[model samples]
Structure formats: C-alpha cells, structure tokens
Target: MTSEAKETGSGLTAELKELCQAVSEDFAMLASLHNKEPDAELLRLLRDERFPEGLGLRLVEERGAQAVAFMQRALSALPDQMGQADLDELAADYADIYLNHGIQASPLESVWTDDENLVCQDSMFQVREWYQQHGLMSTDWRIIPDDHLVLQLQFLSHLFAAGKTMDDLREIARFMDEHLLRWLTSFAERVAGRCATPYFAGIALLTGAYSEELRELLVSILDEPRPSPEEIEDKMRPRRVEEPVEVKFMPGMGPVV
Candidate 1:
C-alpha cells in the first residue's frame, strides 16, 4: 500500500477506536443511572455542564437531539444547590419507577417482550445464553435476571470497549438487534410517560435514542445493512416441531384399550 493509504488506514482505525470508547462510556453512564437511586455524586455529575455538552455532541441525530433536549430540561429543573430533600425526592421517584412491585415502568426485557408480561421468562434465559456465549455471566442472576435493562446496558458497554475488529462489531450489532432493540423503545416510552421525575423520563428517552443511533453507527462502521424488525422477529421465532409422545396412564386412570 502507498504511504498515504497507510496513513489513511491508521487514521480510520484511531477514529473507530475513539468512537468505541465514547460509546462504551455512554452505555456505562446509562447503566449507572439505572442501577440505583441518584446520590449527591451522581446529581453533581448530571449538573456539570460538561455532561450535557458531551452527550449533546454524541447524540446529534433527530431522535437523539430530542433526547438531549429533554435531559437538559430535566437537569435544569434540579436545584443549583441540592439539599437532602432534593435527594430524597429523587430517590423516591427512582423507587417508584424501578423498585416498586407495581412499577409504572419495568426495566426488564422479558416484561416487555413476553406475552404474559412477566419477568424471568424465556427472554431472560435467552439473554443468559448470550452472556455465556461471550464467557460472561451476571454476578447475581437471582437478584437481577439476565435480561434486566441495567445488566444488558453494562454488557453492551463491555462489548464496545473490548471490540476491536469488524467481527466484534458485527457481534455487537447482532446482540443489540436481537435483544435490546426489541423492547427498549417501548420501555423508554413507558418510563417517559409515567415516571414521577423528569430525570428518569429524560433518561428513558436518551437511552432509547442512543441505542438506535449506536446501532446505526455500527452499521456505518461495518458497512452492513441492519435487518428490519420484522426480519429479526422471524429469525428469532421458534421453528422446532415436537414429536408426539405416547400416552401412558396410571392403572386406576387407564381407559379401556
């Protein structure tokens, strides 16, 4: 290759790496926000001008722009000097949305995807299998199912940070298409509509938009077309046919045969 070509290739590699790092950090931040109630440290971080500026820059598309605007508005609603009362209110809102049994919005993939709207269902097991394929496992699956939003976001962060090749990006794209993208938009809309605090509502919108943008970014980087939602659904649907089982009965319950 020409020296100019080599320089271009190197520059592109550097740019891709920077992009992955930024995306990884963004996922980690979102995971942290959903993992627990906001504390003083988190509150301070949100209020920092750099936070919004950096996020706004990263989220430049139309959907992402809306998310950034909502988040900025929410942040602006916070007190300049946060007090215990402020923290308590935020905590309560968090609990109402994330911790309550009758939560307005659930943060589990199964809840949104399952027909019965239950947790710890087939989707959770499927997600667990995906983690195992990656040689990764959640620290406590009992407490938090494998398909929980926080864990999934953390997994994406891990994937982006560790991904270095086109194949790795492909895997990330596949995982997002198969899992997070399936229900994230619905979850985001629910949270945005029902959450008591504007912060979480903003976060919900941001997370949804960011995931969409990130998926598009991956498509651009990999130079591959993303499958439609219907295509993904058809691919994921079960195609297995079970064999008929011979009927056996207890002596007392047996019919004349």
Candidate 2:
C-alpha cells in the first residue's frame, strides 16, 4: 500500500477504537443504572453538572437531540440533595419496575419474547449459550437469568471493549439483532409507561434510542445492510422441534415401553 493509504488505514483504526471505547462506557453506564437503585455515588454523579452534559453530548452525537432532552428532563426532576424519603421512593420505583414478582416491567428478555411471557424460558438458555461461547457465565442463573437486560448490556460492553477486528463488530451486530434489539424497545416502552420515576423512564428512552443508533453505526462500519424485521424473525426461528412421547397404562400397573 502507498504511504498515504497506510496513514488513512491507521487513522481509521484509531477512530474506530475511540468510538468503541465510548460505546463501551455508555453501555456500562446503562447497565449500572438498571442494575439497582440509585446509590449515593450515583446521586452525586447526577448532581454534578458536567455528568449529564457530557453524557448528553456523547448521546446527541450518535442519537439525536431528543435523546439528550429526555435525559435532561429526568435529571432535572431529581432533588438537588436527595434525602432518605427520596431514596426510598426511588427504591420503591425500582422494585415495582424490576424486582417485584408482580413487576410492572420486567428486565428479562424471555419475559418479553416467550409465548407465555415468563422468565427463564428458551431465550434465557439461548443467551446463556452465547455467554458460554465467550467463556463467560452468570454466577447463578436462578438469581439472575442470562437474558436479563443488565447482563445483556454488560455483555455488549464487554464485546465492544474487547473487539479488535471487523469480525468482532459483525459479531456484536449479530448479537444485538438476535438478542437485545429484539425486545429492548418493547421493554423500554413498558418501563416508560409503568415506572413512577421520570429517571427510569428517561433512561429507558435513551437506552432504546442509543441501541438503535449503535446498530446503525455498526452497519456503517461493517458496510452491511441491517436485516428487516421479517428477516430477523426468520433468522431467529427455533431450529429444533421436540416430538411427543406416548405412554400406555395397563389395568394392573402403569407401563411404558
């Protein structure tokens, strides 16, 4: 290659690396917000004037101004100095939205994708397989299913941070198409509608918008066209069918052969 061509390639690689780092950080932030109730450290960060603006600028560059606007509104609604009552309210909102048995909005992918709207379904196992392929697994599937939104976000963060080649970007894109993008928008919408706090609602909107924009970015980087909804559904269709088993009972005793 010419010297100029080499320079161009180097520049592009540096730019992509920077973008990946930023994207990874963004995913980590989203994961942290969703993982639990707001703690003092988080509240302190929210109170810091630079935090929202910095985050907003990064988001607006990829997503649009509307994404930043939602976040600003939510942050503005928070008390200048949070007290016990404020913390309690936030905790309750989190529980109602994510933790409660009668959760208003579940963060598990299987709950949204399964036919019966239950957790620990086929999607959870599929996501576990994805994790295992990367030499990672949840500490306990019983406590936190593999397809939980927080875990999925953390996985994307890991992928971006470790991604080194076009193949890695393709894998990230494929994972989002197969997993995150499939149910994230619906989950965000549900959270927005059901959550009491503007904070959760705003984050939901921002996260959904960010994921869509990130997918577009990956497509641009890889020079690949995104699949349509129908195409994705076809791709995601179950690959195996289980056959039924018949059992015969006799008058003296139940028997199966």
- Residue 168 lDDT (model 2): 78
Deviating ranges (above 4 Å) for candidate 2: 1-12, 49-52, 61-64, 101-103, 239-257
User: Compared with the true structure, what per-residue lDDT tens digits does model 1 show for residues 128-232?
Assistant: 887876678888888888999999998888877777777778888999999999999998998888777898888889999999998998888788999999998
lDDT of 2 at 110: 89
On lDDT, the leading prediction is: 1
Q: Which ten residues in a row have the lowest lDDT in candidate 2?
A: 1-10
Off by over 4 Å in 1: 1-12, 239-257
lDDT (10s digit) by residue, model 2, range 27-77: 888888888999766877865764445652155454545766877877777
- List the pairs of residues colliding in candidate 1: none
Query: For each candidate, what is the lDDT?
Result: 0.81, 0.79
